[model samples]
Target chain A: MLFVFTYAQQKGTAKNPFILNPTDSTVVWGSYWSEMPPVLHIHSGDYVRVRTVLTSNPEHLIKAGVPANQIEKQLIAVQAVKDRGPGGHVLTGPVFIEEAAPGDVLEVHIDSIDLPIDYGYNGIGQGGFLSDEIFDRKTKIIHLDREKMLGHFADGIEIPLHPFFGSMGVAPPKKAGRWNSAPPWIHGGNLDNKELVTGTSLYLPVFVKGALFEIGDGHAAQGDGEVDITAIETSLIGKLHFIVHKGKSLQWPRAESATHIITMGFDRDLNAATHIAVRQMIDYLMQTKKLSEADAYMLCSVAADVVITELVDGNVGVHVMLPKYIFVSH
Target chain B: MLFVFTYAQQKGTAKNPFILNPTDSTVVWGSYWSEMPPVLHIHSGDYVRVRTVLTSNPEHLIKAGVPANQIEKQLIAVQAVKDRGPGGHVLTGPVFIEEAAPGDVLEVHIDSIDLPIDYGYNGIGQGGFLSDEIFDRKTKIIHLDREKMLGHFADGIEIPLHPFFGSMGVAPPKKAGRWNSAPPWIHGGNLDNKELVTGTSLYLPVFVKGALFEIGDGHAAQGDGEVDITAIETSLIGKLHFIVHKGKSLQWPRAESATHIITMGFDRDLNAATHIAVRQMIDYLMQTKKLSEADAYMLCSVAADVVITELVDGNVGVHVMLPKYIFVSH
Candidate 1:
């Protein structure tokens, strides 16, 4: 028998200790702000269930002929919130983790991400990445098959879905001022890395007290580079477990899945970004795999795959993926 | 029960028509030159069994403790070629093809790449891809298990091998002057794309008469970026089928395997290069799959992957890979 499950009901069973809803007024719409108040405060090693709305306006979706019944009610309510963004994404929260301060790392374990709807949209704009090459704006509505775990694109084409949050970050350093939720930076907002699906843990450096962590921009499926500037943009409910590492600090976002360790680098210059990713990967191998710096560097060339995360993001992203299977011991 | 086999005996049947060896004095060392005379000439749709030596000096290999017996006699003799280049790669040839001229496309189908030796080397120099990040120069000899199709990296590490020619291209336009083999331009030299393995076909724009096609810099295996500037550098004997497409013209190199169609872009500006790749991919999908430009662009975002081919190439390379499976009809 088919049954509907609510986030509250899922959390009531004690599977999730804290649940943060996007409907809360404290939600930061469009941009990340260090000065924004925390919506919820929790300690290290706490499991928080969070929800996110697609980075789009309900009116736009309806205008594009999306069925009214399929429109998310929470998203409709979120549009009425007075406090919004200086940017474009409807970010969920800057949930604070107690004792998370500078010189520490906030490790986020993505437990699960579920699509609340059976449809999503992909948009391409004239001013987006590759705009010079493709000078046109377009949007596409895609149907998602939950059971098949696929996004039906055309008559015979289907995209295998691997849902993940496009944006996940702690607040920027206090002096960085308000940040747009588009270009990913040291703070890790809008990473748009398709590989950070379920079973992955994202590690971001803590810049301020309590590590105001935020998450949003859900994508049902995406290829590397997010070439057309969007994926299957859809609303999502996710469960994340946060742990603050006291002595550990990171310069950029790092992630690990069941089989691969991921290191990311972002900069306006792709070469510089690539360098950052390779250097970060070398550091990871040296620290975790206990390889010499030279060996790590050489191993990166022979083993690790450096992929373009996204070119659309103002700061282009590059990520190095090192398969864990290559390591003999662990 | 194991019997020794020679290349000639292996091709005893009427399968391959020409087998070109590298020991011939007609090899082009280091740089690609339009003036370099063709070593061999064949008509369109001809099969060539070409052999390439690893890009290293025999003296250097011996100094690195590679067993003298393991060094191929052809490589030792190739080092004596006086007409070397301003670069460092020991490329095999400028095999001319009849009826191939400027404005036409040369299709090189890679049938097979076999490693003649059981070992390979990976080197990291001071001026390669991640040179700024890694200042030291080092090289490591890796053991290859041909039967297992893997490169043994260390005690607990094994690298799966997918051998390919790192440098494959036709002569650049005669007016461009002598071109260094390092940067991949419109003529497609030193692409270093790991996906161009066996069963793949690489299409290049012909810039001159006979399309002086050259191929070398064999790699046992490589990651996407070739981050440390080298893969498991090794000698390879590959069989290639050349076909001339007089009606089809291309602005850049394109490739297709059994499952994926590949488009490449090269520029000093990675972003521009990426844009070129995305544009080319969209164009390809529209032309081959009968999709509209808008649909193809969106399809690329949802299904295709853009990978960093290499950053060290003077003109950074980006390639868009669209899985052919997306199309229902072959």
Candidate 2:
């Protein structure tokens, strides 16, 4: 797998980008470790066309009503690897960003996300918020109307598709060792925030050398809490533009979409997460919009929308979305 | 004060709504009690053009940067309300919905919400999410651009207005004496869910005879979480059409907007509130959409957006929003 990696460490441009395919060697099963060797190397401002595969069992897909022929061959091909999880996702890469270092911020612009397959699965099982009441462990195959970007959940139920990667992060600090990929931390793994779709820029604090970036857990569409445990799980292809901001610092992950500035916090306690998210937004507003601490607090109360990013992620997520239109000159 | 109420019971139509003003006779300060005398008795499907008053001091409004002349006189007049709270709002009515009874549901259709004042205030005090960190309690009066439907928070900050009644509901169960008008219960007071704007139907469970309803704490605009403790608080006039669903029942407050179906949960713990909201949505999808228990839970995971309605309201609010468009047949 390392033989297929682009290790030249040359500057990659928009026109000529490094393409990565989801293979057993390039993908890790259910863990984000600082020791994971870099699969590819690219310079700042370079674009990477990355492909990701789902982690669910291929036999389960057929049981869930997906035809055998429709399954992505890469997903079936990658399943033979014996390595699996302390978590449950087959994430692609620990792509090394050459100039990135600790204490800096790595900004990843999610340029586009397109479905690689025309079907996805939603499973309900134990370990969700309603795990006590709902004991049925089953999966349903949802046919994706890729052209229209809708999921046919049932005859009458059609879910709108907003495809995005559920996990995107760099390796944690060396001391943290192989971090379980279930909970998101300051390094930004398994965020499960649906707002980081195409056109959004996710800013994560670089925790180690090369800012070992990784991405996977494709969700065609997902609700805020991901309360039932999974989203419309499927394979996806995304064009990510990576840029490392030298000397810049971020305590937690922050994202900015075209319409709003979003700050996120992940913790077992939702209120503690909310406090972190709100404080981040206040800090953002104080720095960029140039408002006082009090004014920023007041502005967030009156203007920002705080949403549950995902409740089931070990460290449940809370995000504060502050609209950018409000910051315009009169 | 009692003599000013419209004692004659009557049916109100869309063309001829019974007008209820915000005088001491019609408004109750800070409580939702079953024993509170009904100010107006209206039949099912009655339209009430209700006028509401702000609860803040006029002197504070002036201190918050509003011109003294712009302050609504009704707000100043309502200050004599000595029968104040276990909460702080001065709300209008315990208006009797004639056919409503225990086990029934009172469906209040918010037909229209119009700003009656040109200015609103956002005050950050001692009880907010960051109250411990922010000690300076202050208020800022924001200018409302009624024509453009914006609130000028500052020179460059303009908040879009989505007017709503922060507190709205019937009396609690007769056994539960006068309840504080702060935390929302199954009776639905101070939901602070910003999505309950115009063109929405709020279905609240009826706990007492007549389902004595009240409304107040007009917010010109408010974000989710209401972190700093208030929105753009001001006076508003709303056109409310009340219909009593006699045979229907609801466990918690459920609402439907033009675009989505909403379910709410309130608790001091946000996670508990989230559990309640998701379960309510699951129940809702199961009952209305006729999906099996398993499917409903799965559907919520893949489609519903759980949002924080308000964090400062003693019992923090969490609501699940399921888009209505997804429920239609192909």
Candidate 3:
């Protein structure tokens, strides 16, 4: 498949006149640029593949069973090095779009995440929300054995692994700037949704023409809130396909798997995040299923639920759940 | 089955003093005044029968479903009359337990929730969280059909029903007085956990000698944050069974089901709430499992998740999740 990509070089300046803020929108594209859009349109079962550069090059790892303290020097050694300049987080254009648009929702089907075992557990501290505390003083660099498939806990509790990308967003609008890689906007950049796992279809709002989207910052595994900041941060190869729904507009992103309809809301405060989540779910019910406000509020209380998507991330996010089985769509 | 109950009446005062401020070791004996304790145990199939009173029984649902203009008339009607003090939250508790003590954990298994149809929906005035300005000026009395589920949304989203208890706790262990039954304390009062549904196993930290636990404030349905400040308030008949696990000191209450382990932490601030949740989960892993501190932290980052259990309730509460399928004991 021909995957389109827009490379933002460090020395290059924004051709567009709009000042890109880190919060509002996440992507900027000029009309005169020759490179293709980031979004890829494909069929449900189509297999799409793309590779990404490491956030930091010269990434190091500890051999299996090594003491954690030994890696202290290695972290200090690599903290200041900028490997590929600022030209990171490039997007693979709308590769598979049978039907997608601004008013419509785009469902991305993620299949498998391929990891390169060479630099297994390196490049985790690239400066995000919790990077200073977790990577600087707390955790250790470790490798994951494909066989063990277990996470370490204090008592005897073993954690499981479910990995996905950190930043995956479509271009905002033709007018919005190629925004910073910090906040999540309409086009769905830096969403950091944990449920974007295998067999999940993420429904994103399409703002720009052709939904110029991109997906990178692959994580091996991450907990909700990403409190320690960095997950199993590593370069990964992801295979997925996309389907777009035209003439539809979603206020925010929605995720659906075998379980429920997930409505995502990210904000600075927990309550604000909660409000966004509740409001969107209420709105979803109103528009998609046709319920009144009072009924919608009640439904949210009963069937719909609110979840703290991430509390420790720079921005706390709350997700509202609407179990699909409860209300079947006609 | 004869469920052993301890009924306590104040000797000089009208109300039970134990229900207000519970001591870490004495409140249990206070809530229950009967002789020897029986098997205060409840398992999966057993149903626990509980008698509950109204939240504002003295206040009454005076102007329910009444327009804003009629509220004055409704209050005037009540002014001429006085509440004989029979309708407010009448908890049949201080249940006597033989094996529960401070540092012990009480496991309450919810079997079923039964609600009254007509008198279910409670009304909130304009000053509450979801003020009348946000909602409507009139008192909206939501009627629930016990036979059939009820939920509302704006568009067409139909909601399913899942009923639960809003205020279920062992009284506070610090101070003594007529404490406002609004916030959650060390004993877990007013902790509106929506997931406290059937098939859920809830674990509360035992503070007093016999665990002076009183459960009431049944809600037909409620969202996670309970942002509107009120749930589908109703008088409920709860069928629950209790089991006591000794020699365990959990800092907060915990809940478990077939799929996940929920550890709860309550605090006044969101940050503090999150810390309580994280610390409690860490404590759980440490006490139950055999992992180290760093490993536990990593495990939390990779597997354990924190949730905003009750945000609007006096103190913001967080529920950390430990998925069960990943770590099961043989």
What value does the lDDT take at residue A88 in candidate 1?
A: 80
Q: What lDDT score goes with residue B197 in model 3?
A: 80
Please identify model 3 stretches exceeding 4 Å from their true place: A1-47, A52-58, A62-107, A111-158, A173-178, A232-237, A328-330, B1-48, B54-90, B96-133, B137-163, B198-201, B206-210, B239-248, B328-330
Q: Per-residue lDDT for A107-202 in model 1, tens only? A: 999988999889899988654566765766777888999998889888888888889999999888889888888889888999999998998999
Q: Which tens-of-lDDT digit does each residue in A1-330 have in candidate 2?
A: 366756563666676677888887888888888888888888889999999997587788888787889878888877876787778888889899989999999999998898988989998867688988899987888899999999998888899999999999988889988888889988899998999999999999998999999999999999999998899989999999999999999999999999999999988888899899999999999988889999999999999999999988889899999989987763
Residue-level lDDT of model 3, residues B1-330, one tens digit each, is: 899988643221112111221122211211211221322332222234664544433234554643344233322232332312212333445454556777788777776667643345534434333453357433335556566676432223434557777767664453433334566656776778877887787888776666656766767766676655666676666667767887767667778876787878788886677777777776776677766544555566667776777666667777778787667575
Error of 3 at A23 (Å): 28
Output the worst ten-in-a-row residue range by lDDT, candidate 1 chain B: B5-14
DockQ of each: 0.58, 0.81, 0.30
The digit string of per-residue lDDT tens for model 2 on B24-104 reads 678899999999999999988999999898768788777777788987778877887778888888899989988898999
List, residue by residue over B1-330, the lDDT tens digit for candidate 1.
Answer: 999875432221128458888974757887777777898888887888889999987777887769888899989889788876677887878988888999999999998889998889988876567676566788788999999988988888889899999999999999877788888989998999999999999999998899999999999988888877889999999999988999898999999998899999999887778888988898887887888888888888888888888877778889998877656532
Once model 1 is optimally superposed onto the true structure by TM-score, how far is the C-alpha of residue B274 displaced, in angstroms?
1.6
At residue A278, what lDDT does model 2 achieve?
Answer: 95
> What TM-score quantifies how close candidate 1 is to the native fold?
0.93
Candidate rank order under lDDT: 2, 1, 3
Ranking by TM-score: 2, 1, 3
Best by TM-score: 2
